[model samples]
Target: MMAQPLLCEVLIDPERAKGLSLQQWDLLIRQARHADLLARLAYLLEGQSGVPTAAQRHLDSAWTFAQRQAQSVRYEVASIQKALSDLGIPVVLLKGAAYIMAGLPAAPGRLLSDIDILVPKPCLERVENGLLLYGWRTTHHDEYDQTYYRQWMHEIPPMKHGVRGTVIDVHHAILPPTARLKPDSSKMLVAAVALAAEPGVCVFSPVDMVLHSATHLFHEGELEHGLRDLVDLDALLRHFGDQSGFWEQLVERAVALDLVRPLYYALRYTAQMVATPIPPFVVKALDKLGRPSALISSLMDCLFARALRPSHVSCDSQWTALARWMLYIRSHYLRMPFHLLFPHLIRKAVKKRQGSGSLTEPIVVKE
Candidate 1:
């Protein structure tokens, strides 16, 4: 058996898996699955020779499942595009859907649970009504929940297709309306590029896509999938960084969008953890935009390094839990002011205790 490779190393350099024992392979597969990265591992190892038969079988199975899911998601997206076509709404895909629709390298072997689309805020109501008419209904029917989303949330309450059971998140903005930093949605819409293959389907410009991904990852409360999200950032940078002038454009756009902080953290951590190659000039430019203090930087490094690792039993530690909680609190703090956050947290806690609120809360409708 060869020496056991670290998770990051195995991802970056699949040849490192050459001589692993069956037990080691098992552990790696389990860890990758737990991190929502099994399909990515499959993609990396598919063409490599000398993989153990058992590991090969696991990889094949994972790849097949991922491909099936990706197809379904694409079909759902097409149907959605058709449904909203008559409204003349320019449907801008976000996150997983965006990567897949744009045919980015990050698309293959990706798993998607919900389809996210952004429309202009002015047409949000019309879009919702159109979706409802097409058999997509809100999942939540509670009055307070409906009010909460309309008043403060970035997206409407998630809707599900009546017949297909597909979930969709319709957004008019990237961040919550109440967030301290609001990127100009209209500007993002203006810069969106139309998909050549799919009429009415569009995606963010490369720079804005990276900014939005960074913002989503850093501002999210959930850390269980932090590792997966980081991997996405790494993949995105590698794919888009190959273009000439990409780095300069990315930095300028981040400044224009007030998203330099998230870009800084994304570049910093991807460089540290995944050995992502970042240009020195880009680093210097971002540093001039305001780098964190040494103490704060050190603290965040500790927290993120731990939280962004695979969240399997073998990886668990007291420090990991503490770091995740701290980051969770930090995410909420970044999302809203204390005056709003306190009550929001309290309401969430109450809902959780009552077993009424889950990560995917159903939309509430009133009579």
Candidate 2:
């Protein structure tokens, strides 16, 4: 069967298009044309002047007013970083902020709507309280919603600053309770390096950062409309290369955290889309995690169906299914004792059936 025609225009910039192979060009254009992705696309296209007319038109069509909104977000991010420093909480700005601070040339033009900062788990309350004092407050919700954010979620309630109106996502962990897998944030903190020339500010080690990005996409099940995120995984892999023990370390880390399945999805999608270099040893390590069975595949399909493989783009139901299974299998492996699993499952089902009600309701004895 013939493949669907790619929407991005042909590359006209000789220099910009120079080192890229045909497949790389295809990935770039496809990523650039992603819906809700004009900011990131504009950032990637900044240095190249001779973009194809067709691609330029496609980009123009995708651009939105959010570009201006991102500017305010950027300024507020800088201020928040300074504030975090003042409170003696070492902050590592993740994703959107890190990309900007790196001076990647692929920065600036991209739209950034939020500020993500990481603090040690022990310092989580202190950091949240500090941000509050600096005028960042939680969303208005009932006690249940607050409890959900403070207890179950990896991050605190999304805090909005009074003056800036900018949202800050303060993370103490990378995954949510629903993810069923957890990485050691403490270990990540220890391996982190201070942001270049930015004292008291730090970011994850390159491998951890990349893995975290992949996990964010995989666990969030947000790939169906994820052409830009695919580009992110590609860029990180290409930038990091295979010279480092990245793949092996990633496998080991995933196993330690019981996150092997997400790692599998990450490697598979990255390889399929960007042809990322995966060393032989890394492939060998994946063997231990085993491949997903048919049952696992169907489960992943349900999870990522709405998140990653939206029909408007590509119908990657097969890929989504496979990813979902891997995720579920990993979740099963990550579970504690059999006894704990059943009770947890029952509680979750009951909570889910409560239908948007907060989990704060207390159970009472029958009269």
Candidate 3:
């Protein structure tokens, strides 16, 4: 009988028979080799034996840039944190960037594109204004977009410094379009502990951070390098492995927040990817969500396609069809009240054309 193929083999990209001379490309392949990320690394590097070259190149550059940008961002973020501190706006860094910035050894060399920070809603304008004073400018500024952000979304616009060229995403809430789930950003914030050295900036409580990363993966339909996200899940679980009550609290919080679905998907994927030991009770709770195994398998095939990079969407029609349907479902869930959902959606469609769309505009931010 044939043995099962290694997970690494099933996950990695096939090797390139040619064009290995590019230093950046060679370095990536070599690092992936050392890091055991080779399959996905090679998959990303080789351009069309059937895949698109430009997309391959773009993703490659992003990967390389992410490594180079890491050291610089730590200092830059520290400076920004100081500036926010002066203004009394508390800032919390999110995800991989947060992990790296906290001086965690294994994290520094990994790829990260942006720094995510969360500030209180009341201080949203102050944070933006503070960053602007420091020579960071908002990239996607339109009155309509501003109105949408100010009135509806969970955060203000993303800011990019002209000189540094690194983008900082400032968020006030973890999940937007509030009706879809109730994982409270406030609870997350309250649980946030200060990074030991980077005292000014905070990180999500381990469970919240892991949950957020998982939600981002599953919610986006796991469309990018599936391996990269799997790596993130692995890292988070490994980091938080010894924490007592981590799993139990995660489920209780998800149940209270109505975000059990993504939590289930996250646990299932993590269990599959890294063999994390989820309790049988947790497994049974997930099973009650009704054949998630089959549902996610179907969703993976129909609702998603892994493009190495964002611009790889060569066909507008195909991209739009998938995006539109996803947005429709997302918006429908965002509207908890079915009776008002359609009219709200129509209003949103009009506002979107007028460039005033946002997921949480109608819900007021309470102190």
Q: Estimate, for each residue in 1-367, the C-alpha lDDT of model 2 and write its tens digit.
A: 2232232222122255545555655565564444335555655565576665655665554444334554554566567766677766668778767766664432444455477878888888778777787898887466755875676578888888786567788988787654557677777777878765566777777777777777777655334345445556666666765546766677777787666776776776556444567676676677558457878656644554333432233434445456655555444334344554566556656868977787343422111
TM agreement with the true structure for every prediction: 0.94, 0.70, 0.67
Quote model 3's TM-score.
0.67
Q: What is the per-residue lDDT of model 1 for residues 1-367, given as tens digits with 9 covering 90 to 100?
A: 1122266778878888888888889889888888888888999887888888988888888788888778877888888887888988688999988988888888877876788999999999989988898889999899989998999888999999998888899999988877777788889988999999789889999988999999989888898887778788988999999999999999999888888888999999788767788999999999889488989988998898888878876676678899999999999999889998899899988988898656554433211
User: Residue 90 error for model 2, in Å?
Assistant: 2.4
Off by over 4 Å in 3: 1-66, 103-109, 225-227, 273-279, 289-367
Best by TM-score: 1
Instruction: Report how far residue 209 has shifted in candidate 3, in Å.
Output: 1.0
CA lDDT of each prediction against the hidden true structure: 0.85, 0.61, 0.60
Which candidate has the highest lDDT of all?
1
Q: What TM-score does structure 2 among the candidates reach?
A: 0.70
Which pairs of residues clash in candidate 2, taking residues 3 or more apart in a chain or in different chains? 223-308, 224-308, 224-309, 296-325, 300-324
For lDDT, candidate 2 versus 3, the one ahead is: 2
- Model 2 ranges off by over 4 Å: 1-34, 42-74, 104-110, 177-179, 222-225, 294-367
